[model samples]
Target: MDFGILGTLEARAEGRRLSIGGRRAQLAMAALLLRPGRVVPVDQLMAVLWEDWPPASARTQVSIVMSGLRRTFRAAGSESEIIETRDAGYRLRSERVRIDTLTAERRVTEARRAMREGRTVEAARGLRAALALWRGPVLGGLDVPGFAAPIRRWEELRWRMAEELAEAELALGHHHEQIGDLTSLVAEAPYNERVRALLMTALARAGRQADALAVYRDGRRVLDEELGLEPGRALRELHAAILRDDPAVGGPDGPARPAPGIRPAQLPQAVASFTGRRAEMDALDSLPPDRDRGSDRHLAICAITGVAGVGKTGLALHWAHRAATQFPDGQLYADLRGSRGEAGGDGPASANVVLQRFLRALGVATADIPDDPEEQAAMYRSLLQGRRMLVVLDDADSAAQVRPLLPGSHACCVVVTSRAPLEELIAHAGARPLPLAPLSRDAASELLRRVAGDALASASPAEIDHLAEHCGRLPLALRTAAARLAARPRPAGDGLPAPRHEASVEALEACGCG
Candidate 1:
C-alpha cells in the first residue's frame, strides 16, 4: 500500500486508489500511517477519532472503520495484507506500506551527503524533490484535532527544506533565480531569520543591494512588532555587510562556513578536583585500543551506569580528558539531561539537536544542516569517516536517545553516562557496560581530604570515617560536605574544626545523594 499522509490521508495499491470510509475512518487511517509497523491501541484510535469525550460505542465504530479499510485494501488486490490486527490494537505492516513522508526523509538524507561531497547542483535538485513531496499542508482538508501537531511539524520541516534549497542555490550562484521564491518564503514565515538572511543575500548578489536592505528593514519591523525581538546575529551581520557593500557578502563562494579539515575541540572541562575510579578509568582507557583492524572497523562504545550522585559524569569526564590524546580529530560532549531528576529541569536532549551541534562543530554550515534526524545522523557519520574523534554523551536517558548521536566509524570512540543500564546499547550495539558503584569508605575519605585540604587535617580518622559512612561514600555528597566544611571554619575549642554529623547530613540533602 502506498500511504499518502504528506498531503492527504489516502492509500493506494498497484496503482489503484482505495476508497476509504468517512472522517472517522480517515482519522484511524492517519494514526496508523503515522506510526507504520507499530501497533496503535484501540483506545488510541478512538481518542484520535473522537478526541477527549469518546462515546461508549467508540470501540464498535472504530471496528467498523477498520473493517471498511481492510475490505478496501482486499478489493484493491494487495499481495500482502497491509493492516494487521494485534491482540489489543491494529498495525500497518512496514514491508507492505511505503509512506511518502518517509521517502522524502530518505531523499533529504541523500541530499545532505551530496552537499557534503561538494555536489552543489545534485544537492539542490534532491532537496527540491523532497520538498515537492508535500503536495500541500499535511492531511489537507482534515480538521481533526489529533492531526494538528503532526501537520505543524511537517510544515516546519517543509520550510526548512526550502531554506536548504535556497542555500544550495546561493552556493551554485543561482542567486538571481532564487530571489522570487525566497521572497515568497520570507512573506510566509517572516520571523524565520534564516530565510531572511538568504533573501538578503540573493537580492544583494543580483545587484539589488537597496532592495536587499529594504527586505531586512521589513523583517526587522515584523520581528519587533510581532515578537518584540530584533533580527538574529546572522541577519544583523548580513545587513551590516550589505550596508558596507562587502564583496564577500554574496559571492558565488557563499558566506563563511566552517572550513573542511578544521578540527573541533568541544569537550567540556574535566572535573578539576576529580577523585577515585581507578578500575572504571582503566576500563574506559581500554576502549580505544592500539590494535589495527583494517580500514573498516566498528565504533567503540562504553556506557557507565549508576545511581544518582554516584559520580557517573565525573568518571566519564576524567577518563575522556585522559584519553584526549588518542583522538586528535577532537572530542564532542553533550549533557543529555537524562538524569535531571528534579522538580524543574531541562528536558532530555534530542539526538537530532545533538547531531546538528556536532556537525556545526565539525565545520558544516548551519544553513546547510538538514532538519530530518536521519539525515543529520547520516551527515554526522559521513563527516566522522576515517577520523579519530571522541564522543561523550553524558546523562543519557535510554539507548534509543543515544543511538543517533553515535558515529559510524571505528576510529571514533563514544562514552555514555546514564542512571539506567541502557542494556539495549550493550546488548545490540556492543557497548561495554561499566556499572559504577559508590566510592569505598577509604576513597571517600581521601576525596574529602583532597577537596578540603587543611580543613580536614585537624580532623581525626574516626571523625572522617563517620562522616564518609554517613554520606554513603557517594563522591558528590562527600565533595559537597568537604567543600562546605572548608568554606565555613568551625573551631572545636581544641584547635580543631568539628566534623559534625548534622552538618554532613545537610550537605547530603543539598546534593540530593541518591
Candidate 2:
C-alpha cells in the first residue's frame, strides 16, 4: 500500500485512493501510522483526540470511530484485515507501508556517502531529490496533536539538506546560478551566518566584489543589533579573504579540500541521555601525559573494563565526543568482540579486517595494505606515528585480540572498553585500567527521574534510595523497574498524579523476583 502522509493523509490500497471520512478518521489513521505494526491503546487514542477534557462517553466514541474506519477500509476492499483489534487496542497489520519521510532520510544517508567518496556534485543532486518530497507544509491541516514535533524535525532536516546542497553547489562554482535562491533564504533566516557567507562568496565570484563586502558589513550590523556578537570565525575569515581577494576564498581549491592526512573521525554518535560519569571522564581526559621516558615512547592508552551493562561503551563514546577537538586528524572506532560465547555473535574480529578499515580511513589504498598480521600492525603504527589521533577499541573479549591493533606511536591516544580486564594488555602494553562500576545511588535516582518523568519528585528521599537499592543500583535494571512503575494506571477518581511509592511496590510484587 502507498502511504502519503508527507502532505495529505491518504493511503492507496491496490492502486485506488481509499477515501477517508472526517477529522476523527484522520486522527485515528495518523495515530496508527505514527506506529505501524504495533497496538495503539484505545485510551491513548482518546487522549490524542481530546487531551485534558475527555468526555464520559470517550470510550464509546473511540469504539464508534474505529468501527467507522474499519467500514471505510472494508468498502474500499482493504477490509478491516489491515487494522486488527488487539486485546489492548487496534493494530495496523501492514509492515509494507511506505512513509515519505523515511524515503527522504534514506536519500540523505546516500548523499552523506557521496560526500565521503568525494562526489560532492552527486551529493548535491541527491540532497535536492530528497527535499523534493515535500509538497507543502508537512502533515498540514490535520490538527493531530503532538504531530507537530516530528514535522518540525523533518522541516529542520530539509533546511539542513538545502544548506548542504548549497555548500556543494558553491564549491563547484554553482554560485552565480544559485544567488537568487540564496538571497531569499538569507531573508528568511536573517541571522544564519552560513547562508550569508555563501551569498557573499557567490557575489564575489560573480565579480560583484563591492556587494560581497557590503554583505559582510550588513551581517555585522545585524549581529551587533540583535545578538550582541560578531560573525563567527568562518564567516569572518571569508570576509577577510574577500577583502584581500585571496585566491582561496571561492576558488576551486577552497576549504574542505581533500588532503592526505589520516584523521579517522569514526566514533559513533554519542548517547544523548548519558547520565553520570564525571570521574571516569576526567581520568580518560588525563591520559598520563607523555613524559620524557628518555625516548619518544608515549602512547596514552586507557582501557575501560567493566561487567555487562556497566556502560563501558557508553562512557567511552561520550568522552570521545568531548575529547574530539584534541585529536584533529580523526577518531577511529572498532568493536573487537573477543571470546566467542557460542559458535557465533561473540568471536573476536580479526586484526586484518580491522587494520584494513583503519588503513583505508588513513587514506591507504587497498592493494598497499600488508597481508601478514604483524606487517599490518606495523604499517598501521607507521601511518599514525607522528599524528595525533584517538582510537577506540570497544567490547574487546580478550587481550590477544587487542595486542596487534595498538599503535606504536606515542602521538596517538587509544581507548579500549571491555567486560573482562585484559591483564596482558595492561602488563605488556601499559594500558591504564579504569574499572567502571554501576551508577551510584544519587545518579541512579537521577536516571530514574529522567526515564519515568517526575515520579520521584515528591516521593520520599528514602523511598528513592530504596528503589535504587532494589535494582542493585544498576542503570539497566533501574530503567526496567522504573518503566513498569511509570506505566501503571493512575488510581481511580484521583485527578492529580499519584505518588510512585505504591506503584513501585506493585511493580516489585508483580516482578516475582526471587
Candidate 3:
C-alpha cells in the first residue's frame, strides 16, 4: 500500500484508493502513520481522538476504529493486518507501505547535502524535485488537533528548501529569474531576514538599486510596525551596501579584489573588410560611462542580437577594436556557442567552465581557481573590481549562462552577441538592447564591392543589388557570395551570372558560416 500525508491523507492499494474512514478513524490512522512501526498507548490514542475530553466509552470507540482500519486494509488485498494488535495499542506495519512524507524528507536530505558541497545547480534541481512531491499543505482537510505540530514543521521545511533554492539561483547569477519568487517569499515571510536579504540582493544585482533600498525600508517598517523591532544587522548592512554601490551585496565570501596590473587583450581578430553599422557601433561605444559610477542604464552591459550570420560578432569586434583605447585594464572575450551544433558539445557551454577560462585570462593562477562555479564567479567579479575592462560574450545561449560572466564593476562594460535577443538580460540585467537587422541596400552594395572587387567591377548596380538580395543581405552570405564571384571567371563587361540558390547554400553550409 502507498500512503501520502504530505498533502491530504490518502492511501492506495492494488491500484485502488482505500477509504480508510471518517474523522475519528482518520485521526486514529494519522496517529498510527505518524509513528509507523511504533506502539502508541491506548490512552494516548483516546486523548488525541478527543482533545476536549474523553468519555467512558473512549476505549471502546478506539477499539472500533482500529477494527475498522484493519478490515479496510484486509479488503484492499493485504494478506496480513497492516495494524498490529498490542496490549498497549497498535503499530502500523511499515514493511510494505510507502509514505510520501518519508520520501520527500529523504529527497530533502540529499538536496541539503548537495547544497553544502557547493553544487548549486545540482542542489537547486534536487530541491525543486523534492518540493514537487508536495501536493498541498501536509494532511490537508484533516483538522485533528494532533496534526498541528507536524503540519507546521513540514510547512517550515518547505519554506526552508525554497530559501535554499533561491540562494543557489542567486549565486548562479539568476537574479532576474529569482526576483519574482523572492518577492513572494518575502511577502509570505515578513520577518524572515534571510528571505528579505535574498530579495534585496536580487534587486541590486538586476540594477534596481533604488528598488532594493525600498525593499529594505518596507521590511524595516513591517518589523517596526508589527513587532516594534528594527531591521537586523544583516539587513541594515545590506541597505548600506546598496546605498554605497557596493558590489558585494549577493557575492560570496566578500568583495572581489581587482587583478594586479593584468591587461588581457583577448578579443578575437576583427573581421577583415568589415563594413557598415555606424549607428550601432556608436551606441555600443557609449555603453561605458566616463566616471566610475554607472548611469541610469543598468551595469554597462549591451546585448547585441540578430539573425545568425547577420554580423553580430563582426559589429561587436569592429567596435571593440575601435574602442580598445577606452578600456585600459583589458578586453576579455568568449564564444558561448549558443547554437547547439557548434564545437564543445550537444548542449550550450557550461557557465562554470567559461568562468574558469576567464579567471585564467584575468591573471588568476590555475590552481588558485575554486572548483565551485559560485566561488569561481565570485572570484572573477572580485578580480575585475574597480578595473575599466571590456568583456565580449559572443553567441550567448541565455541570460543564466551570461550572468556569472558579468564583472562586478560598473567601469567595466560587457558586449554580448547572440542569435537570441536575450530578453531576460535586457529586462532584468539592465542590458541595452542593440538588435541587428540585415544591412541596408547601399551598405550591402558597398560590402560586395569591397569583397568581390574586380569580380563584381563589371557587374551593374542593379546586378550587385540582385546578388545582395540573393544573399539575404546577411554579411556571412555576402562574403561567401563575394568569394564565389571572385573565383569564377567571366567575360569583360559581363554582368555577374545570377547566383543559384542551391550552389550558394551548399557552399555556405560546407564552410559552417553559421
RMSD of 2: 13.0
What tens-digit string does per-residue lDDT give for candidate 2 at 289-344? 45345345657898898766667888999999998888876889998775345336
Better of 1 and 2 by TM-score: 1
Please provide TM-scores, in order, for all candidate models, with all chains considered together.
0.56, 0.50, 0.50
- Over 23-111, each residue of candidate 3 has an lDDT whose tens digit, in order, gives 88888888888777789889989988998799999999999999998898888898887888887888888876887777777888887
Q: In candidate 1, where is summed lDDT lowest over 10 consecutive residues?
A: 492-501
Total backbone clashes of candidate 2, pairs 3 or more residues apart or in separate chains = 6
Model 3 score (lDDT): 0.82
> Which of the two candidates, 1 or 3, achieves a greater TM-score against the reference?
1
Of the candidates shown, which would achieve the greatest TM-score relative to the real structure? 1
Q: Which stretches of candidate 3 lie over 4 Å from their true place?
A: 250-514
- How many residue pairs clash in each candidate at the backbone level? 0, 6, 1
Over 4 Å off in model 1, which ranges? 1-258, 341-343, 492-500
Error of 3 at 343 (Å): 50
